[model samples]
Target: MSPLSPVLDGPLQRSWPWLLAGALIYLSFGFTEMMGSDLWWHIAAGREVIQQGSPWLVDDWSFTEQGSAWHNHEWLADLLFYGWVRVFGVASLVIWKWSLIIATFCLFQQLLTRISGNALAALLACTAAVAIAAPFLDMRPQLYSLLGLAVLLELTLFRSPRLKALLPLFLVWVNLHGGFVFGLMVLAIVLFPWRECSLAALRRAAFTWSACALICLVNPDGLRIFCLPLVYALNADSPYRSLGEWRSPFEAGGITSAWYAYSLVIGAALSLTWLLPAVRRRVRFSPELVAIAVLSAAMSATSRRFIILWAMAFALLLAPFAGALLRQKLVQPLMLPALLALTIWGGLRVAPYSLSSGIAFHYLTAEYVFPHGLADFVEANDLQGKTFAFYNWGGYLHWRSDGALKVFIDGRANTLFDDATYLDYVTVLGARPGWIETVEDSGAELFMWPRGRNGVRLTRGLLQTGRWRLLYEDVRGVLLAREGFALPVTLRLPDDSVDTQLTAAYLASKKGDTVATLAAASRAHEQRPWGRATCTWLRRSLQANGQLREAESVMEACRAYFPSKYLR
Candidate 1:
């Protein structure tokens, strides 16, 4: 009998309700606020593409590389986002994001079910995969690459492989996102079969692989498309490598989060299946799948971006064993209930944070994560000139100002920026020696910067130079202009929001100005009496000012309002 024959007669045949429940629960995990930093520029770019006839190949959005070549790999995806927003409104992008996520996971579950013949096992594997992938599933072009991979695996790796469909898939995928490189790698791996090394099978796989690769070149980038990944990898001096997503999980610290640890465990388990002959004999995993799983795991270990791919591969490679475990005497009786309970627990944990008041998506500026307020101040004052900005806020500033305010750098990174440009940005941002000179040399009239820990040194340095005058300040960002620069009006502490007060407290604490820290923290606590972070900051500031009794009182209030563990 075929491996899938038993599925028709198994409990899965009657488990539609359970599968539906699992899918809904999985969808809940993604219902958080849309807060991707790069998303703003994407929308802006998409708008430009729709208004114009074609995507701009030159970087006109930044002052540093105004005419530099921009390898716009994700133009198609950006256009789609723009179309969705234009027709259905901005909130629709959230729905679009969740739709892609659900589709990808659905494909994963289907593939797992076909391979393992156990819907319950497939569901459990998908849940584990979701746990690892949830953090990285922001609304971006990368989502297309993820969904593409899922579809590719379903078509190529599952029973009766559809090799011909991959050509068109790659043709479209190359335009959607740069992740088509991974799909090409997977196709190449599948060219060689594990046990049966037939010449005909080899020829077929070779033709499909070559055809898909050539189809990828049909995009706007042409031959340059193939060179993009290489450029990112080979550039040793590129500051983009220092980004958190690019760093290896083993670096700085080893396997910090439970999700990373879980991925490692999955990778190790897959490796052991090949290393141990006994286990290999028991589990009839395809060698190509094993190779793909190993490659994905290694890539994920080296760079965090590949974790979702590894998670998908993990479900594919281990589903059979997961199914076998479910059938075991000890597990079979309790498996269904345990899985349901676990799903419920996960949903409950996520729902509190995921559930929002409304679905109208807005740029996330909370805690200075973005420069929404600074951008507003600049636009309101008609401030225009070369601006030095925090790197993360580059996209938002460009989008919000509609290209009136160009930035030194943005999320485009290697796509438009060279090593020297990024290095200069890094030097000035860190307030390294000669930073003031670098800023002066750039002729930047305005400085749109953060006020948090990352920007504290730079903010202090700008103040000390006595050349940059503060134009605006908020909880998240500070806007400054060169001496004698024109300004319509200056709004200092524009609102008495808790975020502004918290920024004040942090800056004061950094300078060891205990009196200012205490005053700011006290105001912040009053503004946000129930906020855990605000409470903690207030308590610490009070303790620093030698008010032990007041600090104790703040801690007591904090304890009353929040969980004891949160106080710690």
Candidate 2:
């Protein structure tokens, strides 16, 4: 009695190659550099677990919260990542991430094909899904949750109406990520027979839900695993809420381009599902799909991270409607192949940029995104003591320095440090009134922070106090040591690349050395003329040195190279 059952016979049967090719190509978009900050900490924790033979329940990574209770969810996923890196290598993680993404999408594609009974319709939908998911497809424990949700949906919705498989799914899911709580909510929705409501069905659902809930307790956290979601929720005043991923998609300045695309696709799908009944008259209503969609959409409204779950629910809900459209005689011959061609074309365009041409593993640490160079300087000079670093750089510093530099704070956020500790960190980082007292009380010997707008004020405050010496600086980060700190080796500035030149220009400008600023900025601009930061710096440096004609020429060149909005 499926709405798409009528479309079971068609030319779409012969279009499997096109569908497969397009799916592979579209999924290929996930292959890129490993850029996430969380993965380093996850790998570090995984190594610790492997060494200790059990997950650590205390925060040992940071000096700020040395003995604090840690949730350590995703321990299993961390172990898997460590084992893969141990056996295969770090570069192989990119492949591991891609494989999980492909498998997740395949599950989604399968669900769409089963519900819609059309491969072409499923391919088109999945292409959009991949686009929506691309930004979040980094190599992290969350990838396991994504794959777990897809498998859960496949078992409950696509396969026969049975809840037996959910036991094993929840058993593994509860350890892999805290997202299992959301899965449990989804299972509750799927277990209820919306089409046929009876006492027998309700009783069966209750039994299955109880069984799944019990199975979730098999992890190391025991009963504590179920309370993990509540732990995050109750920490309403936690500084982690400032993170963009935790922000609502509808929040001002929080909406991403990807969320916009997701909205358009979901909106179009809902329109088709509701309006198509007028044209076809035989369109069927699925109350279960509607209920799940409402739940997921509500969650997505609160946090952007839940949009992937909403995408999964909406896709299945959208399938039959997509299939119904595919069945029309006029649409079948003209529309299907055109959509396939467009998907293939998109795949071809993205493939070259997406595929790894042998993994450049150093890019993970070497890139400007991290403070790898500062870490190198600290390690080479054998510098030691408690370090206060940017929140994002803590994991990299911990991993790259091999625990030699104990950080004051890290990405562990609410899991390790409480709101009071985070507020103190915020106070010092922002260079607020009590920042000096806060820093002194913490006994931090080394200060490492980004050299960008966020850290410039803190850096200036430290320098102005005459108690913190500038030890090292790069385009991305600056390292300062408390006065009287001994350096075994004399500190030297690296003049190797545009990054260093830009940093030199910035430092010179701060000291009112116009000639030095212009010199450094000119070199940086010549090296990377297309760089927005470099161009802007070079123009300002030229103007400061009284070269107005040259500054105007640089401005004209920058305007030609970039959009007017970007120049502004």
**With candidate 2 superimposed using the best TM-score fit, by how many Å does residue 566's alpha carbon deviate from the native?**
11
- The TM-score measured for candidate 2 stands at 0.82
TM-score of 1: 0.82
**Residue range 1-568, candidate 1, lDDT tens digits:** 2242144344533456456656676676564333477887888888877655777566777988887777888999988988887898655676787678777887777777777666677787887787777767777899898889888877766444565677779988999898899889987786565556799878777877878888888887898888786454445456787877666666773223357666677666766766777765656656776789888887777676677788888777667777766655576667557667756765665453422212224321122266655666665667788888888788887678877788888888888888788889888877778888888798788888876645767877787889988777765778888897776655433344666677788788878999999899889888766565578888998888889898989888765553334454
**The 10-residue segment with the lowest total lDDT in model 1:** 357-366
Best by lDDT: 1
- lDDT tens readout by residue for model 2, 187-278: 88878867667999888878888899899988877888777664543445656776676777777653253654455466556745565657
Scored by CA lDDT, what does every candidate get? 0.72, 0.72
Clash totals, every prediction: 0, 0
Off by over 4 Å in 2: 1-11, 14-19, 28-35, 161-164, 230-236, 258-281, 351-354, 357-366, 484-568
Pairs clashing within candidate 1? none
